[model samples]
Structures are given as structure tokens and as C-alpha cells.
Target: MSRTVFCRKYQEELEGLERAPYPGPIGENIYETISKKAWQDWLSHQTMLINEKHLNMMDASSREYLKQEMQKFFAGEDYDKAEGYVPPVEKE
Candidate 1:
């Protein structure tokens, strides 16, 4: 059986990540508190933010902005969205 956690984002028990996404305390916190689904969602959103905002990952400010957004995202606070971007409709 897989591990389960009370995911911070979803606010309920769900499947947990097999390992921390990266080294350090924050990653360990995510492994303990964030669900796999939430992490995947963040990745997709992060990609959209990077592309739409033309963020340069090598820049410290850009990285810091993403880090702040990531915190807000998991905290269920108001987070920035890709301006004027629309989601594709799902097939029935």
C-alpha cells in the first residue's frame, strides 16, 4: 500500500509522494504535507506562469517570485495567474 497524508492543499487524506521532491527542509515539508496530485498541479501552473510571464529561471528575482507564488498556492491564498490565459475545455 502507498503512503497517505492529510494534504495541505486538498485538506484531506490522499496519496503521498514517494519521496521529497528536492533536498532541504521545504522539500521534506512538502513530502509530509503535500499530495502528489497537488504537486502535479503546481508543476502545470508553474509552467504556465513561466511561459506566460516570460520568467527567466536563471534570475534570482524570477525564482523568488515563483517561490512566493508556490507558497500562496499551497496556502490557498490569492496567487497570480497567467494574464488573459484561458483553460482549454475538457472533452465530455
Candidate 2:
């Protein structure tokens, strides 16, 4: 059975990740508060960020920017997105 968490991004209780995505306190906090679905969404968003911005993972500042952006994204704050990106409309 999967675990559950009160997802900060979705603002609801949902299935949680099996393990921390990273190996630190921030990862611990995410495991305790973020749902698996939300984390997956972030992964896609992160990919877009990296690609659109040409962010180099080897750079300390790039990693720090991503960390801050991740925090903002999950916190329901205004976070940066790929320039000229238009979110696809969902069909109901």
C-alpha cells in the first residue's frame, strides 16, 4: 500500500512517494508533505526549466536557482517557467 501526504502543491491528501527524491532535509520535507503526483509534475517542469534555460547542472548557481524555483512551485507561489511556454489546455 502506498503512503499518503497532505500535498502542498495540490492542497489535498494524496498518495506519497515511496522514498525521498533527494538525500537531505529538503527531500525529507518533500517526502512528508508532497504527493507523488505533484513530485512527478515537478520533474516534468524541472526538465522544461533545464532545457529552456540551458541550465548547467554542474554549476552551483544553476542548482541553487532550481532549488529556489522548486520551493516556490510547490509552495503555490509564482515560480518561473520556460519563456514563451503556454500550458496546454485540458479537455474536460
Instruction: Please name the candidate that would achieve the greatest TM-score relative to the true structure.
Output: 1
- For residue 7, model 1's alpha carbon misses the true position, in angstroms, by 0.5
Tell me the tens digit of each residue's lDDT in model 1 across 1-92: 99999999999999999999968998999999999999999999999999999999999999999999999999899999997998778999
lDDT, each prediction = 0.94, 0.95
List candidate 1 segments past 4 Å from native: 90-92
Model 2 clash pairs? none
lDDT tens string, model 2, 1-92?
88899999999999999999988999999999999999999999999899889999999999999999999999999999887977678899
The candidate that achieves the highest lDDT relative to the unseen native structure: 2
Clashes per candidate, residues 3 or more apart or on different chains: 0, 0
Q: Which residue runs does candidate 2 get wrong by more than 4 Å?
A: 86-92
The clash number for model 1 is 0
